[model samples]
Target chain A: MTPRLAWRLLPPLAVAALLVAAWQAWVTLAAVPAYIVPSPRLVAHTLVADRALLAASLGITLGVALQALAVALVVGVLVAIAFAQSRWIEASFYPYAVLLQVTPIVAIAPLVIIWVKDTHVALVLCAAVVALFPVIANTTLGLRSVDPGLRDLFRLNRATRWQTLTRLAIPSALPYFFGGLRVATGLALIGAVVAEFVAGTGGQGAGLAYQILMAGIQLNVPRLFAALVLIAAAGVVLFSCASLLAWLALRHWHESELPPR
Target chain B: MSAAPVLAVDAVGHTFPSGTTALTGVSLAIADGEFVALLGPSGCGKTTLLSLLAGLAAPTAGSIAWWGEPLPPPGRPFGYVFQAPTLMPWARVAANVRLPLELRGSDRATAQRAALAALARVGLAEFADAWPRELSGGMRMRASIARALVASPLLLLLDEPFAALDEFARNRLDDELSHWWRDAGFTAVFVTHSIQEAVFLATRVVVMAARPGRVIADLAIDAPFPRGPAWRASPAFATLCADISRRVAAAAERAA
Candidate 1:
């Protein structure tokens, strides 16, 4: 790795190592029971022992989160475009969209589980619901933020509706869309875990949340800590991916992605 | 000169939606190949008149005709340069210049050639790939001018385009604009508050006054072309500038 990259990463790693060392020291010094709060060494041992089961559950959970995000991105943009096309349509429908967004996903997940036959599909649908609003809101605002002078220029040249939307509105909305993507990535994972908790599915179609639930019942505290670490890592990875996507798309022109002078 | 009237504004007046009167009884018949400057102080409806001529807006009281037809005759395009560069912040300089041709659905190869030629004309040939934010204020305005002239429209309208630039940039652009006008021989209407600038470029200076804007004088500028800094420094140039300045001051006083 380059010296710059190593230097940039140093502080965060330093902080995490200090925290882990303190946790290990406290558990050993206090003689705390493993079931109550597992030591760092015990949690690491559990993670290695339960690798196959945890990895399978993690794969399932991540698949659901990623798929839900994709669905939200595509559907949200289309809805935003429809809203952009007409104020009347937006006026009529936007309130309902906001209503859907504000309603707690956890409160709604049980109903979603009951309504859908397949538990996995229900989980994806619930996650998509939770992640949809940011995309719609940001993209709609960006579409409406077109410069008046640019609009006049387009009109003077007799640009068609499609041409204006594709050339002007879409390109303008990209920065905002990527911003929405970052928020939605985290929300999608939260939605998936909540929906799984509500459904309480186990055995063959189990996710990380199910593993956590099972470990909690059995008082397998080290295993539970291992599962929590996996979830946190997954969240961080997903967020990083969204940021990378945004940087790749906007680095050349956008103000946000340019290196600070 | 009684040449064909390229654009005729017959007693035009405008009141904006905000209930502010911008123009009153503004009538003019611009002849072919004339470089007319709408010289006035701000709020004199110089820009309002230019917008009407560009067909961006309609007059509330009267009509404007293009080539003896209604304003903005379809398929007959005109060039327009706004005060701001107005380049898409995301696009490269060449893409911004190429926009008009691309909007009209010209093919890729042809549009590329024309865009390069236009960039070269504005002395920005090498900066074609650079972003707008990379360029200085003067260069951005030059890119805007290049975009305006890229399609080679028959009538060009510029609304105080160099107002925000430094004096040196302003003077340099003014000289370049005079050369472009002389070479192209297009009907041009330039709006400005600077009396020296109006006298420097226009074949005729149409002086106006504010507070419900109206024309007060039409002075013919019979100065020789190929004007440079030497010409601007001459007594003849100073006399013309002084004459127009007095007329503008008198007109402002009359309006008050």
Candidate 2:
């Protein structure tokens, strides 16, 4: 990285470090009760002690979320292409998609569990639905929003519809697709956890949500804080991965990925 | 002169769905290898006529034909450049130039070679991998031209391609474009508001009246090819510009 960009990044890094240090100091200085507010050191100890359990739960959550996200990416993009092809299809189906987006996933998770009759499948379906809309909306908008002049230029070249869609529309939609994916990555995680929360864990094993609930019930505040930290870390990892994918896909040509110099 | 016309615009007219008429009973014919300029005031249907000729839009009345074959399917017979560079922002300069070839199912290697050749023609080969955002306005326009030229279409339609450029860039591009057209041997229909530009680039200038656009005058420049700055300062060049300017002013007055 250039010195300027490195320098610019320092302030945020320093602030985050300061916040962590302050949190550690405050928790230690107060001699807070573990149930009320576990110290960072205690949380760390709980994490190491319950390493096996935490790793298993994290594996389960990650597996479910990634499966749902994969499904959403495929189905959402296909549906978006279908919508882009025909105004009538867009008119008929887009509102239902909006309906799905607006409807609360928490309210629907139990219903999905009951309907699907398989815990893992139900969880994946609910998470997929939660993560699917942004991809559809963004990709569709990108596909249809091409410059008329460019479209004309393509037409004048005798480009087939498929060629136009694949060569022009899809590439044009990529940034938007990645934009949706970034949003959906976080949503997929939340949906997986919430589905597990509502559906009472099954399939492979319990997830982080179950651990949190169990820790809360047992009044193991250190474990609870540890689970919470794991969840936050998982979220950060998901966001970073999604952001990295976006940067990789767009960095060479797109303005969004231009590196500071 | 003895053979069939390369392009024929037969009593073409256009009225938007909003019920505003842009052209009325406009007609013209262009020979093969001709460079024709559609010159007029703003809103005089010069672009409308070019669009009709390019098959971007069908004339509400009358027909346009190419070499006795009706204009191919609204988009196949010609290449077009809009007033704006209109390069896709997401693509690199090479990718932008390769668009038409890629659309036509050219393989990556073939497309890359063609894009490189076209970019070299326009002196932008070095910036091929750079994104559109990185290019200056003139370089972007050159890329647009390279794209239009890459397909090797019979007809080239330019809608004020240099209207937005600085005077230096515009004049330089005009000289370059004239040379390219002479060498490429393609029929060109350029639209512009500048009388001097029309005189400088075109063999024939078709001046139009405003609102419900109609041809008011057609003047032949009769200038030699590869016109340089010296030609711009020549007495004959000024006479042609002044004559076209007078006709354009008269057309504007009649519309008012």
User: Which one wins on DockQ?
Assistant: 1
Write candidate 1's Cα lDDT for A203-259 as tens digits.
988999999999999999899999999999999999989998999988888899987
- Supply DockQ values for each candidate: 0.69, 0.66
Q: Lowest lDDT 10-mer window, candidate 1 chain A?
A: A2-11
Q: Which ranges of candidate 2 are over 4 A from the true structure?
A: A1-9, A202-204, B73-77
Tens digits of per-residue lDDT for model 2, B1-256: 3376878889988999999999999889999988999999899889989888877788899888777777664434467888999998877899888888777778989999989999999999899999898899999999999999987777899999999999999999999999899888899999999988989999999999887889999888887877888899999999888888887787777768
Q: Which residue pairs collide in model 2, if any?
A: none
lDDT of 2: 0.88
Residue-level lDDT tens digits of model 1 in B165-228: 9999999999999998888778899999999899899999999999989999998988889877
